[model samples]
Target chain A: MNLAAHLVMLPVLLPLVAAALMLPLGERRRPLKVMLNLASTLALVAVAVALAMRAGTGAVDVYRLGDWPAPFAIVLVADRLAALMLLATSVLAFCSLLFSLARWHRVGVHFHPLFQFLLMGLNGAFLTGDLFNLFVFFEVLLVASYGLALHGSGSRRVQAGMHYIAVNLAASLLFLLGVSLIYGVAGTLNMADLALRIPAIAPADRPLLEAGAALLGTAFLTKAAAWPLGFWLEDTYAAASAPVAALFAIMSKLGVYAIARVWLLLFGVAAGPSAGLGADWLLAAGIATLVFGMLGVLAAQEMARLAANSVLVSSGLLIAMIAVGNAEVIGAAFYYLVVSTFALGAFFLLVELADRGRSAAADILAVTREAFGEDEDEADDGEVGVAIPATMALLGLAFLACALLLAGLPPLAGFIGKFMLLDALFAALTPAAGLAPAVAWLLLALLLLSSFATLIAMSRAGLNRFWAPLEPRVPRVRIIEMVPVALLLAACAVLTVAAGPALDYAGAAARALIAPQDYVEGVLPPPATPEVAP
Target chain B: MELVLTIAIGVLTGSGIWLLLRPRTFQVIIGLSLLSYAVNLFIFAMGRLAVDVAPVLEDGTGNSDPLPQALVLTAIVIGFATTALFLVVLLANRGFSGTDHVDGREPPP
Candidate 1:
């Protein structure tokens, strides 16, 4: 009845309604659709901010659709982690919308509506408290993504989009299989109810439930782009139009978020026999993904492919730390998730602007020269003073910021995030734990090595694009395009400045996740009054 | 009856996965469709197979579980949409690349 009660559903409903409203308008009404889309996204941001503030106060707000009771009817829960994810998504969506307005919005039909639909799906995915509902939302977002990926259609985009679509379709089937198995065994799809039921499940049924969870996890990890399953990500993200790719930076994280939410809630210590289920597989998979991503980053020549590979590194790091199952480390992982997501989105946007100056053959030539060990024909003129245009300077600074953030270089939010994670990893070590300490050390080494690899790859890309050209031809970047990149980088700067509060929020969110009681109780409250059938 | 359904699912899934790995786009699409059919049946069985029973629990006489039916319906609709979308994308890929191979090019003979 009150505004607080309604706040939980607004994020999901706002975009759906906005998208529906935009669908009826004709192509001639592009400006109107854009205006509607922008206004809706801004309002979603406002709602997300309010939700986060409310959740920061440590109150779990649950909105039951049609006022149905929990465990039977659908409910949307807004706890700290959900609110944090919603806030991050809304801000990223707003920026991507702004970036697309410059030219991408006109490149194809129904771009604005599809964007809104994607937002709706993403918000719904984050907010839903039901597993089947989660599957529905995954389908929702994936369908919208399929459209967006193929937008501004080109030969390469179509080729990549086909693989992306086929792979995801298979993943979706796996998702359905997993959900049905869990439902068949647990007899419930509501996450809170499953937490209550899993501990009491028969020992014979336990394996089925775990199998279901593994299948579900596989579906999510495929989206997260882990190791062998992640091969599609590089080509797909590389070939996608810039703004769509930027928006997709969060989509990969969506998989990690789902795992964190569902895995922790259902299989936490509260589940007795089922406690710590699948943690080992997660760790092994995460390590493999990190190593593979490191190799991918080192091998990449194109800026977009490089950024996509770096996304794999971030995802692998998060998934591995999450498997470590320490609240402190999980908290640090959340911090890293936020920072890396923002950095990756900015880098994807910047790739378009920074890449426009050079001919398409530049990157390939650089690679070939490296392979052949060719010396530069031009003599090095140290300290050649060339007047740089203001636009080029701004673009270069943003690119530098992205590079620093992705590579975890010092004096930026990325460095702070890695430091916090490493610190938490060290703090979590114990004598009685046999293999954890070894895993901690391995992860520590991988983190630093991946950062170094990203630095090398990014520097090679930066030199080729910005520094390699003797007479730098500045790309014609519009104000609309530049502002979004600046806004994202500025967010990273702000994150760096306010590290204490950000880390504190992440800690609280992680603690809530590690202890599922709060979420379970929040979703399934004691019956206030017995329902009277009319 | 359960064994028959299980075997059917297993066979469908096996064939689907095989076709999914093939080089041709059309075969891949058929593979996906077969896979979805298998999944739809699998989900349906998750509700526990019942014959000639009302899905709704009116008088509670041999009522089948209704939830998986609903879930399967949603999955079916989504599977249909994605198949159509994949078809369109495959056609577009063919239009651009001038090949039916999933990789967008033919292998040398």
Candidate 2:
């Protein structure tokens, strides 16, 4: 097999194998564990790069499990969108791993294994071509995430973890229900097959199909933290460790990705005018989530909570953009997802630095009290926390990147994405399509208001933390902590510079996704009569 | 029979949601469990009601859909894992905070 074929599977298999390998290694061998993680991520990056190259050349790489034809057996597919997401996934995973190197000792046993398994699950979900496979991968990732979320075993972590697990498990049940109905009616688990078959089902059965679709959408929307279903996110993200929190950011987006894929493929034709809550419902929910998230951000007291709320706002924007359904808007959604993930990942890393800084300062204060025996006043006098000026500056830079990304400031990738989406919405507003015009205007207004709210919230955080003077002394920032934050921030800078190519590629990917007949044909040869579920 | 069962599931869901809104952690867990049961049954119903038919395919005979059965198996396992994880987390929170409240911190003075 060519390298592209290997690329399709390596992202998932490498991590699965690495996780198994790590399990046998002694817990004391931290260096070996780190090496395995780094190696696996590097391998994934290489595969992602190779896949991107192939996709750029306009080739869709499909891997048939057990060498069986489509609709008969499982398949893994890597298209332009999958490759782009794979690249983003690997980039975030690499940066998070780098951040965890120093913090792993704090996290203790099985962190390496669990992290690798989580990556395995994430990659599997992205690559799988079958709906059932997607469910399996989701479960795999959720299991690992449960352990990682509760890693520290603290009271707050536990409380948040319970909510997280409860919500996700409920979503999983809905997912199973939806898939079962889809399969019973459509008689296929293969996504490509379903796409081809679902449209041909009898009009009378369409309502039943819509119910299944709605159930699936509900589950995915809950996972994506959409309005009215996202109550668990703020507290859960706030309580998670910084590195683990960064991983969770991407996890939420996976649901959005799944929703986009299923809607554009299986339901787009069947969804027509008769389907009650198609893209419009998503757009409405997205706007509501955006407004709610911004409010949460403004209400937040802590830096971590603020960042968490910002994630919801960005996710809402992405979902709304996707709902527009125009090729250009979908392209913009892809670009926005990439930018948001990068910015949020960097923000989480900065949170870790700030946390360590506070912890170290506390330790220093304890030592000072011990040294000045019986003189509590002396120990407290003029001795403030140690603040590392350089670390603060780096964190400030990261904050700037995050602010620009979230607020849609110019010269950043977020600005370009939002501009493209708004342009598409404006173009869609034609007098002939009266409803479209009103919806387009509403979406644009919502986007603008959300951006303004984010700007205010972020500025408040920046002013309170960076502009204000710290206590007399603050702990020095460690190099180990600074490296990952700097690397992720640099990635954001590079993404900003490469916005043109990124948007262009996203446009092509979106076009391909929206019109998936090519993908369906590529997966399965046309049948004499396309099977339609009754 | 199916209508009655569906209504029962709906009642369970309503009760679960009510309990979920409570402030206590243990109550929330119980609520989640009740909700899960309701959800599982609801999912099973989506396959369409079958009294005597097995999900397995037989020669030239109608059988209930097997796909939902496979999905339910996966859901059951995942649900169990999540429930176990939740219980562990609840115990850990009780150990640390000396209270079984969902919000660990005391309200601002």
Candidate-wise lDDT, in order: 0.88, 0.78
Model 1 misplaced regions, further than 4 Å = A361-389, A432-435, A527-534
Instruction: Name the top lDDT candidate.
Output: 1
Can you write out model 2's per-residue Cα lDDT over A1-534, one digit (the tens) per residue?
576556688888999999999999886686898899899988888888888888877677888888787777789988888888888888888888877765433444588889999999988998899887898899899889988887655556677887788788778767876776777676788888877677576778777777778888888899899989998899888777778888788988898899888788776644454332477788887888888898988898777898889889988888887777778888888988988898888887776565444553244234423432425334533333333456667777777877888788887877877788888778768664333777788888988888888889888877767767354223355566566777776777787888888888989989888788667776776762254334
Writing each residue's lDDT as its tens digit, candidate 1 over A453-482 gives 999998888887777755577876777788
RMSD from true fold, candidate 2: 5.3
TM-score of chain B of each: 0.96, 0.89
How do the predictions measure up, each by TM-score?
0.94, 0.88
Assign candidate 2 its CAPRI class: medium
Regions more than 4 Å wrong, model 2: A1-3, A269-277, A359-389, A431-435, A470-475, A527-534, B1-65, B104-109
Leading candidate by DockQ: 1
